[model samples]
Target: MGFPKHLTSAIIRLELPKNDGGLILTKNLYLSCDPYMRSRMSRSTEGSYVDSFTPGSPISGNGVSRVLDSSLPGFKKGDLIWGVINWEEYSLIKDTSSLIKIQHIDVPLSYYTGILGMPGVTAYVGFYEICSPKKGDTVFVSAASGAVGQLVGQFAKLYGCYVVGSAGSKEKVDLLKNKFGFDEAFNYKEEQDLNAALKRYFPNGIDIYFENVGGKMLDEVLRNMRHHGRIAACGMITQYNLDQPEGIQNLFLIVAKRIRMEGFLVFDYCHLYPKFLEMILPLIHEGKITYVEDIVEGLENAPAALIGLYSGKNVGKQVVAIAHE
Candidate 1:
């Protein structure tokens, strides 16, 4: 694939392979623009779990694709799929395991880039395994309007927990409350005192904290946690872009409050994907769950879509639709 010289433009030229392994995917759906990718674009001595994208190479991400050709077994032409792929018109996936066959087509294909994919799994595993929520528990989600946070709030509500979320904008705050059915939502940008804000919403204190944005937010939430509270440490979007990440001041509260905080990556719980689908798909079909997506049209917009996440420009799950199937 050929990219623009300046590395700032959206236009890309696809170079057809000399030989096909019989596995070719024409980008037919959307790609997720997540906050985590921001770190990957930078060159740092501290290596990331995933390799950074090399300049002039087509950027890759989690996206929904449709098979255009197949030499591999089980994958035939016209199969709708979603997985990691390059930021171009088409991608050749050699390892078919990365590409999961889409079994359910009743819902929109874009959903796989978010609510039904990595973000969904992150929320499920973080909440169920790390948070260990009980019915009637009060849950707080930071960066609540994001891909993972939105699902976390909904999952908590489905579990009979009182859920509150914190976002960066009024629109996102409204989305958390009105669309996602969060018990209450607040715009952290408008709140002068975060710790006080947490106290206001969760007077009894938060039983579970689905931490997505860290830094000051985590510090505040820690002070407001109920005794024996569980904190599911998901992604820390707040600290991702910083040259120097902020340190939490109130960590001592963890010991004082007997809080149980644990961090997890979705890969650790991949085995539970089947179980997650069984639980969430029904809720989706029955209308018990709602998903919100902020789709940027075409692969050209992928850069801005990813940058929008940090600035809170995205209203919900940030996705880049490469092509419509």
Candidate 2:
């Protein structure tokens, strides 16, 4: 494949395999955007857990695809699946382990890129396993309008908890409260003081805080956590773009309040994927759970969609609809 002149530029081209054991896939759909992809764009000293996208090479991301040709067994033609792949119409999957077979198609195929895939599992493990939420507890989620945050808020509400969410815009705040059924929703951008904002909503202090956007928001949350409060550290979106991350001055509060803070990666809990599906699928069928998606049309709009995540431009789960499955 020929390289584009710019770092952000992505162009499609045909190329022969440089090695064997590679599988070719026809890209059925592409996920529009995610904040993490921004990190991969830069040339950094810190190595990526997932390999960085190379210049002139086809950019890859989590997408739902169909197997076209395979050297590997089980994954034959017509197999529907989702995983990391190129931005082009066709992709050569060098690592077959990254691909997973899609067994159920009764639900929307786009779901495999978001809700039924990485973000869904992230919410499940972070809220259930890491936070250890209990019934009737108070739960707060930062970036509540986002992909993972939206699901977290809903799951907490379903567990019979008082859920409050903070989002950047008025529309997002309204969606959190009205559509997602959060007990209360506030526009953090309007509030001058996040600590005071939290106190106004959660007078008793927060029992569980789902930490999505870090920096000052996290610092304020630390001061407001009740005794033995659990803080599930997901992604720190606030600090992701900054050259120097903000310092949390209220570290002593964790010790004083006996708060428990744990950081987690969803892949660490992949074993629980089946169990998560078992728990969440029934909730979906009963209409106890609702998912929101902000979908962009075509692969060409993918770059803008991904970049929108950082600016809080997306209302819900950001996905790119490449083709109808």
Q: lDDT tens digits, residues 212-318, model 1? A: 88899999999999999999988888888777899999999999899999888887888898899999899999999898999899777777778778888998899
* TM-score (C-alpha) between model 2 and the true structure: 0.91
RMSD for each model, in Å, please? 3.0, 3.2
Give the per-residue lDDT of model 2 (tens digit) for 1-325: 1222233444433342455565555556756466667667767748445566687666777888877666666777778888776676666666767778988777778888778888999999999889899998999999998889999999898888999999999999999989999999999999999989999999999999999999999999998999999999988898877878899899899888999999888878888988988887788778888888898887777667777788898999898887665
How does each model score on lDDT? 0.84, 0.82
Model 2, stretches more than 4 Å misplaced?
1-22, 45-48
Q: What TM-score, to 2 decimals, does candidate 1 have?
A: 0.93
**Candidate 2 deviation (Cα RMSD):** 3.2
**For residue 209, what is the lDDT in candidate 1?**
94
TM-score of each: 0.93, 0.91
